[model samples]
Structures are given as structure tokens and as C-alpha cells.
Target: MSDERDPSPYDALLLLSFGGPEGPDDVVPFLANVTRGRGIPEERLKEVGQHYFLFGGVSPINEQNRALLAALRADFAEHGLDLPVFWGNRNWAPYLTDTLRDMTLAGHRRIAVLTTSAYASYSGCRQYRENLADALAALAAEGLEPPRVDKLRHYFNDPGFVGPMADGVLTALEELDPRVRDGAHLAFTTHSIPTAAADTSGPVAGHGDGGAYVRQHLDVARLIVDAVREETGIEHPWRLVYQSRSGAPHIPWLEPDICDHLEELHDQGAPAAVMVPIGFVSDHMEVLYDLDTEATAKAAELGLPVRRSATVGADPRFATAVRELLLERAATERGSAVERCALGALGASYDLCPVGCCPARTPRPAAAGADTPL
Candidate 1:
């Protein structure tokens, strides 16, 4: 092991996320930031963003991240990790560039970033790295020295993550009418990307077929299903499904969306189903509008009872998992062999993203990887 133990090379942890508007007025601008290069017109964007108004034009992600920040700070202090944690978003208030400037001004030279996203894809991984690089470039233009930044690896298969989700499945099953509980199917849901993006996610074509994105989700779904069987003595039938697809319908994204799958289950005489969002870290807009609002509405229409399982949002065990990841990465950075904690078939992901790990359609400077332009 290294001569040092905790928080040695790292001076701070940055909780980076995709931000959402806090109110009606912020919605259009937030969407504009998200679709910056698409050249979408304001009126057209407003028409597309009409669904956000249904929830008072607010998103729960910013608030959820606030709670998670508190949990991380509390956990780190309790464990005596002594690492200062900061929060920032890519598209809204507390923006990434501003946060990095603040950190550098505060004399923090080294920072480790953790994102709300837990998987590998262009949008999930490489895009965030590109955002980091852009923010650092902005800081440099502002005459501030850029802090060295590294992003944490994918944690989809971490026990702390999968365990809570497994419990969520069990709890949702218990909430069902008990008559339908035993027969209820488990549908693991994740965000749908274009087929090309899925094919290129993670390392080395992510090992064929649906690539690392689908492969990783499958591994997690199987692990959760196995855990449920071990506890309840019933092997719940399950399948990995996709959700929250955007972009042109002609592009062909991941199929059998959660709503459509619900319809299929109903027609097939399936008693009930649980929507497990293993793809997301928190119950963000996608979980709320897509699953809770839209999919639930679809299920109600089909008379099929369904409950959405919980995301890992602000779970204490998840906070502990973040702590463990920090220590593990710290040791690895020190050239010390450390036990990397993960569950299921994929094992641990790389600490630093490899070259061409998850390439964006149009190339851009992305920090925190072998091919980082930083």
C-alpha cells in the first residue's frame, strides 16, 4: 500500500450533474443549453418542452443533488476522509466552469469528479468529459490556473448501488396486492440511445451486440433478480428494457420502451410488473415524467398494475460506496494495489477512460481519459 492512507493526492470532490430548470422561466434556457449546437428554434423548443410545465416547470434533480451533497459531506466527515466536496452542473445554476473557478481560487489544485450518471456512453461519459474540458478552457481564458481533474469510473455494478435497487424491487413487490406480487415481472429500465451509440459504449465495442451499455445493464438486472430469488424463494421473470428516448424517430433508438413493454405484459396476461430504473442514479425528470407520469398512465389505461422501483438517490449506503471508490482510486493513483469493489459479471471499470472509450459523433476535447485533449 502507499505510505499515505486517506485523501492524499486529491484535494476536493466535485459532484457534477446534468442540471434542470428550477422553474418555468428557466426551462427554455436550460433546454437551449442542452441543445446548444442543434440550432433549434425557441418556439419549437418551447413546444417540445411543454411536458415540463405539467410538473410546475420544475425538475427534482437539482434538489436531489443538493440532498446527495449533504449525504456525501456527512459520510466523509463521519469517516474522517477530510475531503471537501463541491457541486456543479453542466447546464444550469452552479455551472461547471464557475465551480471549477471557485475551486481553483480556493487553492484546491487537484479534484476528483463524480457524476449522477453511472454508465458508459457518449452522452453519459464522453460528453461529461468534454464539458469538463470546456469548463477548464473557460477558466484558463479567465486567467485562472486550471485544477487537475479526474472523473470516477462507472459504479453500476457496485454492491452499494445494486443492493439498494434490489431492496427497492423487493419493497415494490411487497407493495403489490400480494396476489399479484409473486407473479409480477421485473422490467429493468434505462435511457435509450441510438443504436450506433450503444454499439460504441465503454471499452472495445463493449464486447459485441448491444455493447457495454446493454451488457452492463443485463449483468445488473440478473444480479438483482438473483438476489430477489434468494430472499423470496421465487425466481421473478425479468427483462432489460429501454426508456426516455429522444431525437428523431427515424434514428432508431433502443426499443420496447417501458410503456410499450407494459402493454405487451398486459396483453400476454402478465399480472403486474415493476419498473426498475437501474439506469439512473436519482428520480429525475425522466423517472418522474416518463415512468411515473407517462408509463403509469399507460399501465392504468391497460389495467396493468405497476410500481416503479427506487433509484439510488441519497441512499446512505451509496454515500459509503462513493467514499470507498475515492479511497480505492486514491490508492491506485499512488501505484498501490487496492481492492476495487463491484458486483456481477463485468467486474470493475477502468479508473481512467481509455482512448476512444465512448466517442462523441463530432469529436471534441474531453478531459479525464487517455485521449483527453486537456
Candidate 2:
């Protein structure tokens, strides 16, 4: 049992996310932030920035994070948790370094970070930790005392996350013609990272070669499929596909792309299709542009009936789940027994990352884990 008299392990919660442009003029600079080290030219980035221009130069991510932050505050208050949540981003405004400085100045320490990304991979997990380390180092160099940032474990298989996604799939199915609904195929989509990164995502000892990235997605996809089956009594076929791939032309990324898979399904005479973005927590620019714009257009061209499902953004259940995770981790830090809440077969992820869990390409400072070579 936890001692009620003891102080909490965490002073505050930090909502960390990948930021985006909020208006037309900020679009190019936001792109520059995202591709700062990739050696991508400004001209080429401007060309890619057209996607944001098409949507009035706004990315739904920041606003979605705002809604999520509000939901978290409300949930915490309802549950009698006094932890205040602060918002920051890896790129763009309210940047991570600035947020850390503000939090320290506001007297916050031992902060728990919850990134918008929910899966395990270099980009999804390790990169965020590295960013945190960078922020702390920068603060220390400036004689600022930064808080210790511990990230919440991946929640891809949490009931709160899976529940909303399953319901979303059902709702998307309702949009299709009744005559073709029975024959609909589920296409689970996620951001496609390089094959090299995917091959080394999770703990080297237990997760095998493909690591946690592919395995976690497959587990969630199966969970969603089973949930849809249990709810609607339809055992629809499903495939875990990749999307929003961006890198050098020669690098082999995950495949087949969602658009390519849609075309294949069209040729095969599939009656209808539903896209469930199980990988992302919110409908960011990747979801809006890649799936909504590019993939939807391809499906239209192929005469394939398709509907895109919604991400779990600002859902009260998800907000409650976040609170549960925070308390659960706090309990563990206090040496108390806690039953982790998760759906499907993978079980709950580790509260703290293990050594050599998800190594970056080169050596870098990362928080909440041991970066020893496996």
C-alpha cells in the first residue's frame, strides 16, 4: 500500500508532442524545423510544404493537443489528482527547451512526460527521449535546474486507446453502402519508418529482430479486429500497412504503402475498405494529408469505396487512461504493487525503458533508459 503521507514521485505531467504550423506563414519554417538535419533543401521542403498550404497552412495537431491538454486537466481534477500538465513540442512554438525552463522556474521537478506517439521505434520512442536529454543538457549549461523527465510507457494496447479506435472503425463502416459493408476489408495504417529502424525497435533480448514497432502494431490491429468482430459479429479481413514515408529514395522503408495497398484491393474486387489509423493518437498532418488526401484520392480513382476512421483525440476515456498510467507509474516508483491496464496479448509495457531497448543510429544522450550496446 502507498503511504498517503508520502510526497508524490512526480511533481507535474508534461504533454510532449511533435508540433506543426498554425498558419500560412509558419508553414515553411515548420517544415524546416522537421527536416533540420536531413540535408533537405529549402526548395524541396517548400514543395512538400504545399500539403499544409492546401489546408490553409494549418495542421490540426496543435489544436488537437490543446483539446487533449484540457481533457487531461479535467480528468485529473475529477480523480483528485493535483498534478498540473504542461504542454511542449519537439519542434515549433512552445518548444521543449523553453517548456522545461518554464516548468523549473514554476517550481516543478520530477516531471512525467507523455508523448503523443504511442508505439516503440526510433522515431516514436527513442527520439523523444533524446530530445528530452538535449533539453536538460541545454538547461544545465545555462545554469538552470531542469526537472527529471520520465516518459510514460507505450499505450498502443491500452483499452482506452483500443476502445475508441474500435468504435471509430464501426462508425466508418456505417458510412459505406449496406450492400457492400459485409465485404469490407480493414486496412490498418501507420507512419512508415525506415526498414533499418523498424528492425531494431524494442528490447534486443525479448522482442526478436523486428523489435517492438511491427509487433506492437500487429497486436493492436488484431485487438481492433477482434473488438470489431465481437461488437458487430463480422470477421473482416485486415492488413497492417504503412504510410507517410519520407526519406531518401534509396532507403527501404516499410511497405506496402497504404495507397499502393488500396490500389491492389481495388484490382482484387474488394467491395469496400475502411482505413483505421491505429498508429497515431491524433489526426495530425500525416493523417490529414497522407491518408485523407492522398490515399482517399487513390481509392476514389480505383472506384473503391473507402472511409477513414478517426484517431483517439481528446476522448475522455483516453484522458482517464492517461491519469491511470500516471498513478500506476507513481505506485511502482513507491515500491507498491500495481496491476497495469492494457488490452490484447502484449500486456502492459515496462514503466521504465530497459538498457539497449531502442538504440539510435549514433550515440546520443537519452533519458529513462540504459543505452548500452546489445
Candidate 3:
């Protein structure tokens, strides 16, 4: 742990996330909030909302976030950090704008934001900044003050983040039958987006030259695969697969959805498969619906056993990683080059988000009193 005597620069830490519906009645409204300004029809939203209806219109994300909040508070207290933690979501109750308003009213000045996402992409990075901008604008309209907020760097490369996920895969493998464990195929899953969006995702100059999204996914997949192999002494084969595709059929999205991948493995005579949701921090709706419900059903239909690995939600190591990130960011002087702490053998640094990173397609209204570039 970094020196605790160093005066903490941030007044509070904010847990920023993508929220979900808490009950049956909230499902449509939550969906509406997510699809707002997209001009998506109510009927179409109802069709998409069927997945939530399957589980009584409740998404596990809110409960999971609550668990994370508790863990964060406990960790902060244990470390004797004075920063208070707050929760805000892009689409749900205790909304981001409202949360910011409350924080500002309570006299918080400098705040640090920790988004639930671990990667750099439009949805993962820039959109949240845009949301902050929206929230600040809203506060401004109400004649309120917006506190200055700085978001922490991505933690995808942090050992504390990756190690827990690697351990989860190993545990999943152990749960399978001996034969399956010995030769189970590993399927790493993440969300699928339009090929065009992915092509232009990062801020790297030549990023769109094909395979940026796939390549980043491959880097994390390989790290976990290698770690699992080392720990279990099982040389299981693995592949990167996509899930939760929301685009129309005309716009090509990432291929071999988790369900389809499970079917393919079964056809190839694989007796079992271990699915690691490397793309997410928790077992959110995508993980629940796609892996638990849809893919599990497919696996049952094919008589092939499939084990889904756990995400890094509220994992102790994850909290440590967040602390390390904040400390690293705080230690550096403002306007200096950001240095990324590399994960073992990952061969990449994810320090500062590059300028123009993850451009938004349809920008939302700015939040009231959000900090803006001078």
C-alpha cells in the first residue's frame, strides 16, 4: 500500500456504473432510459426486454452494485482512507446527475470516479465522460455547482484484477468432471458491437486497421489461458467469442455468439467447456442471459456440460487494484505523462485515456454542474 500519510487529493470516490431495473415494473422504464433518443420503438424494446422478463424483470446488476459498494466501504475503512464513496448509474435510480447534485450539495469538491468497465472503448470510456458532461450541464441549468471529477485509469492490466479472474477459471475447471477438466475447451466471452464502432474504438493512430477489438480481447484471453494452464497443468484449448449483440442483422457484429459457440464445441466432440466472462466485471444481464440462460440451455440440449466462471465483482484483489490505481494517479503531477503499470506478459500499458478516445454516436444531454475543460 502507498503511504497513507500522503494527503488524499480526492474528497470522495464515486462508483459509476451502468444500472439495471430492480423490479418487474422497472424493466420497461429502465429499457426506455437505455434506449432513449435511439428512436427504438416500444414494441422493439419489449422484445429486447423479454430477457429481463425471464427473470421476473429484475436485473442482478443493482444487487451486485450494492455488494460492491459495501466491499468498497469496508476496504476504504480498513485502509484508513477518508474518502467517502458514492454510487451513480448511467440509466437508473440515484442517477448520475442526481448523485452529482447530492455530492455537490454536501460540499464535495475534488472527486475521483471509478467506472465499472475495465477497457477502453466508446461505451466503456468516452460515453461516461460524455455522461459527466451531460450531468454537469443539467446542474448548470439548475444554477448548481459541479464538482471537479477525475476518472481512474483502466484496471484491465492490473494483476489484482486479472489474477482473480484467472483463479476463477481454475476453480471452474476443477468443478467439471475429471475428463472434462482434463480437456475442457475454454471460451472467453465479451459483448459484441458493430464492426464499424469497434474498428474506430481506441485512440491509437492506426487502430482501425482491422482486429483492434479482437486483438485486445485476445490479449486478455491469452493471459487468463496461460495463467490457468500454469496453475491447473491443463493445456485446455481456448477461443475468443462474442455475446450480447444488440445491432440489426444488416450491420455485421462480432461473430460466434456464446450459444452458437457452445453448439460448435459440442459438435466438435468437446465433452465440456469453461466459459470465462473476461469482458465484464460482474455477472450482469449479458452474462446471466447469454451464458446462464441461453448458452446453458444450449449446452443441455447438446448433452455437453458447461461451467461459467465468476466475474471479479467485490473481489478483494479488485479493491486493492482500485486503490493502487488511485494512488498511482495521485502520485503523478498533473500534465505529466501517465505511466501504466503493466500486467505480467500482457505487453501493454493502459494509463491515460488518449484524446478523442471512444467517440460517441448519439450524444446525450449534459449533466448539470459537471466539470468542463477550460
Candidate 4:
């Protein structure tokens, strides 16, 4: 007899996330960390981050990460998986370098990094790997032998992740009037990156018509749509839309924007709509300001009824999914076969990002991948 839940070869689980400011005073400097080397002026960054000012300059991501950390720890402990969890951010306090240093001091030699972003894109995947390399390099400068890191594969189509989103959509539909609940169209939304980035997302050959980014989102939308139909017996209409775009006017990004899609639904006489943020794992500022604040306002202006679905924030199922990913990866590392869970046609993502999986515009060293320099 053998235990299937053993998470061996990985001494620690690191929750890597895109950090945010916790107060009005920390907003601009945090943005500076995020936008460094982009040459974006401080004034423009301030203008862009005005939404943070709306909530006392706090971005909900840090708190969300805290809750998610607790959930993951609780789930792991409840299941007898004795793994220590640590958290670090790319652009704020408890920054990656500091967290890695702490872990190194604590003698964690093998780390499994689980990024908050659940998709395959430059900003989502490779950038975090690059940051890991940078952090390790900093540790090297201080003569500290950094731990070996391996990023868990993408979980965009994992059942645990999609199931929560599907249920959230169902819940949102129930909030609408009975007359419109059956007819409320679904709008699956995600962040909008530049067209070039989207075109080159994930492995080069895997990019479909709109690229891996769009194709993955479409798969999730279909799965959720089918789930909703099975539960309610109504095959409601749906579309994959983009939101929170931050690019120059001349450059192209994913579309139609969620706000635009809402207006389209209203124009088409759709009774109501549910905005499902499948791309984001937590209700960070992007979902809060972009959907709840900006897009919802647009719907109001159009006299359209709309509801925003909950994200998989601190959801126990998501925590379980993370645990499965860890054990599965550990088995893979030990050269043992394991059952990987995923939804839709995409199957499971690669355990390790290959060379050129999600290349940056400028070449940079990335860790925890086939092309990792460390």
C-alpha cells in the first residue's frame, strides 16, 4: 500500500502574487515598483491608479492573499499534508527577495511556487519566473544559497477552479428577476494585454486564432455555460470579453471590452447579464474597480441590469486544487505517474514552462523553467 497524497521533494509551498498597496501613502511607490523600467511617468501612474485612491488607496489583493494563504494552510493541515506555506509578492511588501531569503534561512531547499495568476501569459507566468531569477540572484550576491524553485503548471481549466466560477454564475443569475434570470447572458471577463503579447502567449504553436490566452478563456466560458445549462436547463448566451486594458491607443489589445459587451447586450435587448471574472483568482482591485466600479457604471448608464459573479478567492475547492497540483508535481518529479485534473479540451498544462513558452519583449533570465538560468 502507498499513500497518494504525499507531497515529497517539495519542502515548502510559496504563494506568489502580484502585490498591491495597503494605504493611500503606499500607492504611488508601489506603482513605481510595478512600472519600473517602463518609463511611465509618476503623474500618469497616479492618474491610472486613481481607483486605488477611491478605496483609501488600498488594493484588495494583499488582503485577498492573506485569506487565500489561510485557506490553503487550513486545507493542507486538515488533510494531513504537513507542508509549510509562505507568501511573497512581485511588487510590494514581503517582496519575493525578502520572502525567499527568509525561506532560505529557514532551510527550505525545494520550493513549489504557485502564482495567483491562473493563466499562461507574459505578465502572468514568465514575468513571475523572471522575478524569481532576480530574487535568487540577489540572494547569490549576499552569498546565500537560494532554494530550487519549480512553478506549478497553469490551472485555468482545473475542475476545482471552474466549478466555483460556474456556481458563482448560477448564484448571480438567481439575483436577477425571475423573468430575466433565465435569459441573462454571461460575460466572461479577463485582463487585456497588448495584441503582440496575446499573439505570442504560451507556447508558440499552441496559440489558436486569438492565441492561447483567448483560447483558454473560451474553453472556460464553454465549460461554465454547459454547467449552467445542466443545472437550470437554459442554454444562455455568452461571450468572452476583455477588460482593464492599459495600453497606448495605437497598440491593440483584447476586446470587446466588458463595458462595451454590456452595452451590446443592452442594445440586443438582453434582459440581464452576469459578469464572470474567470481570469482572476481573487477580487483584487482589477475586478473591484474594473468590473464593479467602471463596467457596472456603464451598465447603469445604459439602463441595463447586471450582476458581477464572485471570484475563486479563498474558496476551499481552489485550495484543494492547489494541494492536488503540488502532490501531482511531486510525483512527477519523482518520475512516478499521477492523475492530473483539468476541465475543457486543453488538458493539463506543462509542469515546467519550456523555452520560449511566454517570451518577454526583451530577453531576461527566468527561473523554474527549461530556460531558467539558475
lDDT of each: 0.91, 0.89, 0.80, 0.91
Give the best candidate by lDDT: 4
TM-score of 2: 0.96
Better of 1 and 3 by lDDT: 1
TM-score of every model?
Answer: 0.98, 0.96, 0.92, 0.98
Worst-scoring 10-residue span by lDDT in model 4: 1-10
Clashing pairs in 2: none
What lDDT tens digits, residue by residue, belong to model 1 across residues 141-160? 98888999989989999998
Tens digit per residue, CA lDDT, model 3, 3-114: 5423257778889999999888898889999989889888888888999999989999988999988888887778877678899999998799999999999999777889
Clashes of each: 0, 0, 16, 0
Question: Model 4, 1-374: lDDT tens per residue?
Answer: 13566777999999999999999989999999998999989899889779999999999999999999999999999998989999999999989999999999999999999999988889989999999999999999999998999999999999889999999999999899898888889999999988788888888787645678888889999999999999999999999999988878999888899988988899999999999999999999999999999999999999888999999999999999999999999999999978889889989999878777878989999999988765
Q: lDDT for model 2, on a 0 to 1 scale?
A: 0.89
Ranking by TM-score: 4, 1, 2, 3
Where does candidate 2 have its weakest 10-residue lDDT segment?
A: 1-10
